[model samples]
Target: MTDSYRRQIDKLHDDVRRGRLSRRDFMIRSAAIVGAGALPVLPFGARAEEPASGGFMKLGLHNASQNDSLDPGTWSTSWTGASFNGGVFNNLVEILPDGSVAGDLAESWELDSGAKIWRFKLRPGVVFHNGKSLVAEDVRQSLLHHMKPDSTSGARAIVQQIETINADGPETVVITLTEGNADLAYLLSDYHLSIYPALDGGGIDMESGVGTGAFLLESFEPGIATRLKRNPNYHKNGKPYLDEVEFINIPDATARLNALLTGEVDFIQDLDIRNVSLVERSGDFAIVRTPSLRHFTFDMDTRVAPFDNPDVRLALKYALDRQDVIDKVFLGEGAIGNDNPVASIQKYHRDLPAREFSIAKAKDHLAKAGVDTLQIDLSVAENAFAGAIEAATLYQEHAAQAGININVVREAADGYWENVWRKKPFCAVDYFGRATVDWLFATSYVTGAPWNSGWSNAEFDALHKAARAETDEEKRGADYGKMQEILRDDGNVITVAFVSWRDAVSDRVGFGEVGGLMPLDNMRLCERWWLKS
Candidate 1:
């Protein structure tokens, strides 16, 4: 029986090497193998799960750029984060299926009775990629470096309430909070919390790649490809079996789809809706749909003319048909969204006024405001998403009917992030993450938030700050509810639609499981996947 199974596996790889087996053919053979073997090769059932093995996996990313820094505290772009995930990083906590935190770098952690202090017991014997032993002092130094306001780490904004982080012993770390923070666990689980080695030159840097993660950076070429090799000193047992991973940046969506279909890449993520059916219908490919926590919205400059008028903002909100946008643009792959930060997973998500689609109401507001021909500059990036350009075009057509003219200015990939997205008067951009209410509210909705949609209320700001300090679930929820109410009823922006991310994998890869919103380090388990024989 063993000999027969081995022969089948060998034959599969032989076909792959000879280029005689397309992904579709490989999948067909895989299905036969599954049925022919009465005793399963894997104890795990039919569901595709991550595989553990030694093989090279080629991954396709939307675009690659000069993101050399793998120090998670500072990296922000999705491509950079994905590159870090290959096995070179580990955070204190990891997200579980039920939305609770599980130990990753830290063996155990607990909050004080007052919720003002947190203690973490570190796992011993974990070694960095360079073979250095990981200790509690390394964790403290990395976190404290971010705590300094001058450090300017994005994580500083999220961990604002943390008063101090100290090494209690060689294997213990303690953190003091200026306020009772309930979402500390969530923040720790954030990818940005992935630890860095103890500093030597006044700070820690990953230029040489010295993390306790599963993969080590072997070579990198900005905007072209990044190559990573398995870490031999990895702490996790029986993990990181993949010999190598190469991420090739294919900016064009059509090109990316073509590459995946041609078996040039093993996995492709962020598949747009237009090509989803094409990939799905191809029998050789296995489509995995993960619930997306990412959402894109337009931010208005309320501090400037036109948008400064609450009536103008309210009228614009009524003009947008969220349902129509979702159906026509997203093609039934999205959910309706309001101008609120709280998503469905959030415990405090409250039902506010659903955006009513009424051109008449929009016209009335325009007339009351005495706007005849309204011209607004709308900025968007061509590289961000698949249908963003078309979505903006559709909105322009719809808004024109209501007597609003949008001067659409498209930006290039290289300049959009700095010159257009945030700096532009009216811009469409995506905010991706499973954020706690405080983090999301403070980042985009609060008075001085970097992405604040040109509207600010002192009361809202106070409540946002207090919510982080509350620590009590009920009270925190109430604070977030108030924040949501202010944004929904009186905010300056329109909530568009929540998008779903699609990943298409070839069936030759063996894994019976998929992923949820809570992204794992090896998001799709490339380490656990094996080429079918």
Candidate 2:
């Protein structure tokens, strides 16, 4: 083997030896290096115990709105993603615990026509919660739900490249893209792309919440609570050990943590960093800190005044102390951001130099924008994310030094996402981060994208399109790097920090490995985790 491959194997071995990596992860990485059939025999630690079955699991999650809906198109927050998408529905592809992509509903897939056409073979014997067998028509209708002209699905930007989707047979689907995209499979793993049963008339029936997932929705109370039962007919064998699952909406961090400590809930997400020591002292729970792509941002609407000028945007970017936000607000649980959405852990990530805080530079940029001093209102609420209000307060203090008066407007937590987020000129926003670079940029950065920050650049758009279609790794990396530079230098987002997915779990829960891609084990804890007691 080459030296590079040998070094990778050594690292995986060390990670597994130190208990930093699971045995399954070690095997997965090793097989990728030495080929599955050529993998050498090695001691893989102790044999894992079979998962204990038949117990109820309750989770206290942060932030839920009465506006939440069963329709996947309208689903945005983790509240709906965990309860509905992760538990009650399945996507065509899934991001495994090891961060590898694998077929979920589709048993296998192949690319053709210069990677522009994809053929997916559906998994056999899969049936929906209502006893309807999964068919190719179901996948087609479910995907087409987001492609309609007036469809307001969050996934619209990513799926717009599809030229056509045709059911080749009862068990096969053929999708043709307007252009070649090698990362199309990864995009399909998006939570908003959950497959639902097709209606006899047309389109998929999204209101009923009937899906071919590991769980069946029993009750849904919008922002209050959601209840689900194990799917007896689930395709995966010896899975979804929990007999029932409940998700309670607890917007307050203290209340969410209290629910876990009081044994009212088995787990809680977005744990308050200030209480890390208290949880450790209690010893009744264990903290699961997974390195994640989740990042916090201050979004400026480029369409609005003050922010309409690029120099003003640059002045705002230079006014904040990102390190201070990471240290004070996040309690040093995150890395400083460089105004780029792509995380260091992702492929084709560019190591851009950190944007230093400089009052002089900020003043210079403001002067270039024909302003001696600037004042702007920043909308924020506790519902944006943990420590959002505190971060905005610190930012308010930092910008004052640069002659930038920031008015931090505290909005209500109940309907923050629906009311303040994109509607406000400037606001605090957080993204869980998509699986791929293209998915991330397309969802929130591309021109005319629904979640875009009202900033558009023809150069950046060109690079994005070229990179998505390029199959050459070197060429793709270069294109992605240019896009990152463009965003870092001229983007409307002031990225604060990329935080870790810190969650607390009760000792009663059992699981092998956790996924870092999203909170609560990629939001699949309901199905992958089992109750030990």
Candidate 3:
């Protein structure tokens, strides 16, 4: 890692050590910047594009896949991320707007002296959409199910440190970890922790959306649309006031924008950068732009040639113009990345100087690594992003000067993740963050990790495990910082940019708030948001 980059990580470590960047600060900034504008219970005042007579809100989603699993633990992509937030489930601890821990199903919690053991006391009289009361046993069962093998839920790695999770009583749940978890509170606040009721047969159903969340599932058609209705028996009174909510899947970005413009749908997930100003000028819609944990980059398979050598990988990093990609493609919608996996969510975030972009540098490395005529297969999902086509075009233009022949291969939108990305030579992908260092490390970089990009480092894995085992906040931060250094130096991954999360809403829509860090984490809140009548 560069000395400059190292200093930034050290500075972040110092901030954490000095207590300047507390969880509360992170949450409040996230809430105001991310969760603001869409007032939950407050009125939206008056707007030009008024809603129809009765309270009805229609949400249009663009470029999100269908989530078949209601179990939050199994969520993988943005598709599942959206569904998890759509009232299919609830978690014991809720992460409020300000990054502080809040009570959701569990009203109160206490940590043991060393912070290794945590106890949660649930609130009584909370009922699931199915009219079943949420009890302590349900939390235990839901968490245990996630830890079991064959559970693809994202929380398996994060919760693996827990030695036991059992109900202390009807309203109390206890969690005994093998050691101290610095971010235990944040982990529980994750969207994946949304709990489910105990299943009748054997295990939790993978296809059903059953939970103790605010809204009840009214109708669902995979890859099409999901409709939810207010849960009258919800624990929070006067909530979910809106009679009903509908989430429509419009995968085409242009089509989705059109739907929102024509008043066919009240909201859309992401907006094209070029259209932001256009939408703002219309005065019919409101744009919610917030910095997010989302990171996008390209991966080179170490198992493949050209990228097999570290020098070759580093050369490719120097060859492509990241700023140009962001400027021309993202249209200045994001911050430049330093080819590091750790994103803004980490307390260790640092601003690194841009890597010099030169075609000569790319040619030198390719020549040193081998003969000539470098051929690489570039795989991209058809519906991956708004500017994917444009970005690929630019990459082709710049990389051609380096004598690199990129065979641009596009995958079918339907089965791209299953059939192509996992086993591709070169591909572009993005990942959102988990609150804790261990959670992100375990899922993204650990040995045998599903997202490792076929690159393995023993020292990197060791540092991550050591960080997870350490209880002291300072020591844990130091350990994770070391892992980031290893990743930065090795050039195993290229973090293109920390893209801002974008959403567009009509002025007529009364309650459409977007969370900063993980907006998809709370989709059910839409049920309570209504159009200004």
Assess each prediction's global lDDT (C-alpha) against the native: 0.69, 0.86, 0.67
- The number of residue pairs in model 1 that clash at the backbone is 15
Per candidate, the number of residue pairs that clash is 15, 0, 10
Predicted model with the maximum TM-score:
2
Per-residue lDDT tens digits for candidate 3, residues 1-533, read 34544454445433422223433343454345334334222111112333242466777765445434455664555655555554556677765443356787888889984778999989888877777788887888877877787765567666777899888878899999988776687777666666777777535544566677667788877667778776778786666666677778787777888999998898887777778888979888977654456777777777777667877787677767878988888876666677766665556654355576788888887787775657777777645555665676677777888887777777666545545555787877666765556777777677666456667789988887777767676887778777777676564676777775677888777543334456543334463356676
Task: Quote the positional error of residue 290 for candidate 1 in Å.
Answer: 1.0
What are the models' TM-scores? 0.85, 0.92, 0.84
**Candidate 2 lDDT, tens digit per residue, 188-295?**
988889999999977989778899989999999878999999999998898899999999999899999889999999999888989888887876797766666788
Best by lDDT: 2
lDDT of 1 by residue, 44-158 (tens): 1134454557778888876455544665655555666666743567777766533456788899988885778999999889888777888888888777766665654557666
Between candidates 2 and 3, the lDDT winner: 2
List ranges where model 2 is wrong by over 4 Å: 1-49
Per the 3 Å backbone cut-off, how many clashing residue pairs does candidate 2 have? 0
Over 4 Å off, model 3: 1-54, 71-73, 200-202, 205-208, 303-308, 344-346, 469-475, 520-528
Q: What order do candidates take by TM-score, descending?
A: 2, 1, 3
